[model samples]
Target: MCPPGTMRNSTGATGIHQCEPCTGGHYCEGYGNTEPTGLCDPGYYCPANRSVSSPQPGDLKCPKGHYCLEGTVEPYPCDTGTYQPNEGRTDCIPCQAGFYCESALEPDPQPCPPYHYCPEATMYPIPCPNGTFTYDNETGLASEGECQPCISGAYCRGGYIMDACAGGYFCLSGSYEYTPAGDPPPANPDQDPCTPNTQCAGPCPAGHYCPVGIEDPIACPNHTIRNTTGASQLSDCRPCPAGSHCLQGDPVEYECPVGYYCEEGMPPEECPLYTYRNTPGAASEGDCYPCRAGYWCNDTGMVTFNQNPCPVGHYCERATPYPEPCTGGRMSTETGRRSNEDCPLCTPGYYCPNDTINVHGIPCRPTYECPEGASLEVVCRPGAYCEGVTGVPPDCPGGYYCPLGSSSYTRCFFPKYCPVEVKCLWNVRLDTWRCHILD
Candidate 1:
């Protein structure tokens, strides 16, 4: 037998002819010459109906980007995500950069779309980063284009068209982050509270206050004053001053009117009853003065004009706005009394000294005389100095002495004596004559 891959031919002869080498694409590894032992080497093919009786046609080449096995009549396409570069390839290779091979049947890798990337051995395209865009027809082998920065306040996310940031949100150029709008830089040189990636900053809006960052706007506090709109810091708030009335979120100060008092950071309060504030801009309750004397102020918790005089028999003290009834035997026939002192004391001689009642027609003590309108009793008059007399005064006795207005008199104490002539008249001197007393 000839060595393997050699061919022997016979025409009904018992013995074999000399052996010959097999053709380039055919292999005859068996004994008798019938045909090449196998059709051809794997990855190569021969045509049908070729046998040992007639020499088989030379093996044909497989088509480009396709493969054929031994005895195969047709070629098969490469696998998905794979490709072949030359004709009659034994196996397929992974797709290259900037191209995509989606299926086995594809003859070659497809180019990546504009503004998109396709990695080596990839089957799909990937979009560019946000806030950036790439031009179509960018055919570099890098698998993607060099993305360009979008315009200010706009973003290009994964597409060719540029879009504007939504309200309260922003995007910066060459960035892929979208962020909410933030507060302005701190006004007082304080640290900024905003997080990174913020696109814009500004002051708090009017009618609201925002202290820091992108937090929600807060309504102004009660009694707020000045142009508080867009206030950025706590110092921007101006409390409503005294002598003024302010509502919540007020933009300007309002002066309190007469008869009203306004404290700081509060609404105006009306003056209390029996009080008056004749001037505007009263700052406190002390500014409301009490009503004048002799007038009856009856209202409460409000400014009043109803001033009535003190009623008869009633008097008002100094700075007193109400009338009080008189007591302690005090009386006044007058209409208006500024004070209780204006009530006169009871009259004299009528004995009206007690405080409870208005005494009238009452007389002084018996046997004791009193002057007109006198409050106390005095001794009886002179010609009436006798003792124990009720209705009228009695005259003094003939032997007694009485003084004017004296209650009693003294009696005269003396005895009578007569003169007697002495006998010695003769001899003597006229100067010596003496008188003698006779018992």
Candidate 2:
């Protein structure tokens, strides 16, 4: 007997007439019937049966890639975004690796476009997330690997093209676009920024400047340094103040050296001749000290106060810039004297050489003495020998007499005819002498 929907042709009293099977697109179950059973069920197939077989061998459902309706011998392909690799499958499978099937009954998966990703079994690709992008070089990327983070100095808009940061602007890491000027930096950072933290804005921070599209802030000019990071305006710069000088890029002003004066925005100026500053950072003319007495302040710039002593034969008053010569017959013998009154008169019996210096007196020649009230030396009075002292002289030698104011004495004997044993006492004023013979 044939199984359900299958049958054979036979009579009641006679032996079985030749057995027969079901026709195409039909089935016979529980044999004993001549006609076929109802049409095959959907998703199943039926074929011509064998002679009196219990069950049909060709009766089966469609494979995974195809759909079969009732009484159908062949199957139709499944919809797109699905795959059927094996035969006689009940349902299709979705493409893996985040790829789409795209076509009905596809043999292989399709990748998403650049900057787009297809999640598992998705019908279409999705755009990359903000601050991320994809490039042609990153082909065959998985869904998670499709979007790459934007790096510093570049802007990403989810497409293949990347833009560079404009001048005076910065594009930090993980940024979508270039930053503007004057944007404040991130706060509470214990160390310098290794990764980009904030979006850049217009104008740079203090101590720096930015032009359009700047990649980094420009440092401040020399002597205009600041501790802060941003500098939005030019007014942040400061000049060197009085008592200090500045060089290019100096962090702090330098103090004016001793004997020099410094004004705002100017180089240091040395104190003029006969002037000096004892300490550094002199700011005004009043800080310079004047030359003192007994000194010659000839140097320009910074003069050492009271450094050069008064020269020989010169005298100096207090605060004198130069030495003064001793006047009249007086002489200067010492250094650092305050005034011409410090000069002394020449010694008695000796005249002070005219215009001479550094001497107490000038000695007169032999037989000449300087009088107390005279300016020059004169011959000693007659009958006396002149010494260095005035009004003090030795008497003329025996038998000879000197005339008044004469330099030497006269002999008592005339030629060689003088009487022997006779002694003469010369009369210097009368030019004659008396001789007395032996008693």
- Per-model TM-score, in order, reads 0.32, 0.46
lDDT of 2: 0.59
Q: Write the per-residue lDDT of candidate 1 for residues 379-417, one digit (tens) a residue.
A: 666434524322244554554544445566545335312
Clashes of each: 7, 33
Residue 349's lDDT in candidate 1 = 34
lDDT of each: 0.53, 0.59
* Per-residue C-alpha lDDT of model 2 across residues 192-256, encoded as one tens digit per residue: 46343333333345455544434455555654444444444445546557787666433456777
- Which candidate number has the best TM-score? 2
Global fold similarity of model 1 (TM-score):
0.32
Q: Candidate 2: minimum summed lDDT over ten consecutive residues — where?
A: 50-59
